[model samples]
Target: MMNDTTFETLPGRRRSDVVYKTLLDRLYSGQYARFSRLPTERELTEEFDVSRPVIRNALAKLRDNGLIRSVQGSGSIVLYEHARGDDASAGQVSIGDFQKCFEFRVLVEQEAAFLAAKHCDRAALDVIRQNIDEVDRYVQRGEYRIGKSFDFHRAIAMASENPFIVQALDRVQDFIGFKIYIARSMSLPNPVERLALINGEHSAILSLIERREGEEARALMRSHIERARDLFLGCLPLEVVSDREGR
Candidate 1:
């Protein structure tokens, strides 16, 4: 809570909404620490000068957003602090660090794909297929789901039967999102085109792995990563990325 923790005089008509934004702002600002319980209904009511119902409704919104969890005995607890554009660290990745990381991943993942092609059992391949189908369904409906695409890659990493590969992907899989940011930057009339291409690339990779074409699978995996890297880099300012890379 701020030293000057302030609230506008919340009127009855929109008190619950005001309370929700107030609490969410606090959560994102770290006024409520992760995993720490929020004030009780009685305390919130007093603090916000709102009814218990207003406070409860406000808490419900946070719960719906997966930001907080409410236990029966305890109160609402903070979970994530989703950084918005204004956050100091938002989208401020070092280009040199990203290039190094991506280069390392290209090697790790190519081997993973090669091994997955050779060793993945039917069940393992099915797990990868399920994630692919999830993306296909979303893309058919014209949604570019970055998380779904990430899940498909994670499944392939798991199918490699290499715990290190799995662990590595878990750590760095979120980097794929820069590709999403780049695709969105283009502002194409058909946003689904980028997603469709991504899904198609995944389908081709999966097919090669399923057929146990280890050599071909490795090649496809490297090409796929390179293509996505190009797409992501294409939209960025070259001078900025080059300057940072030199650093």
Candidate 2:
């Protein structure tokens, strides 16, 4: 139950962007279950009080992002479902793919964190902080919102003042998102505990960035990613774990 005014008043953001972000947040928070139909375009138009074109554009963006699929008569179906115990279905990513994605993040995001520590302005810091707050709120409600975690990392990349870094991250976002889903689902016993661990690492990184400690931020970022990689890899289903070892 989000207040309409929340997206309505985001300064300097387009209407479509607002709609996309809001819907993305909802999808990641499990508000829209997998295979569940979303509100119709007309319904969304009425709810947001925007033009039909605007709603269509937002829906199109969601489809492009792999978060939803459009059925001819059924409207949009949310695709971000909870990961079951099946490795093949848990994001369709292999252990090697997970390792590669994490390795890429370590290479790019560590430098991004270091640069963000040196270059992050107040506004950028606020955006990252807001993302963390959103994650905390969702965790409190027993929901795992992967979008907030992605947003937090992207904001830090933007704060680094490197468009290429942002682009690099964005290009891999879908795969990274799937990886995150698997990790959150399999890494720990309690969802709250796993999310708290992630949120704590994010907060620590943010603190280091704010304190302008570039080296410390970089080191911590590496450790944070590595820890998550190891945890998820260890907790993967036994068959997949065996595959990785056999390779």
TM-scores, in order shown? Answer: 0.60, 0.62
lDDT of each: 0.69, 0.75
Q: Which parts of model 2 are misplaced by more than 4 Å?
A: 1-66, 69-74, 78-91, 176-188, 238-247
* RMSD to the hidden true structure, all candidates: 8.9, 10.7
The clash numbers for all candidates, in the given order, read 0, 0
Candidate 2 TM-score, true structure as reference: 0.62
| Model 2 lDDT per residue over 61-90, tens place | 577546788999899988766454555535
Tell me the lDDT of model 1 at 69.
82
| CA displacement after TM-score superposition, residue 148 of candidate 2 (Å) | 2.0
Candidate 1, which segments miss by more than 4 Å at Cα?
1-91, 174-190, 237-247
Give the lDDT of residue 185 in candidate 1: 33
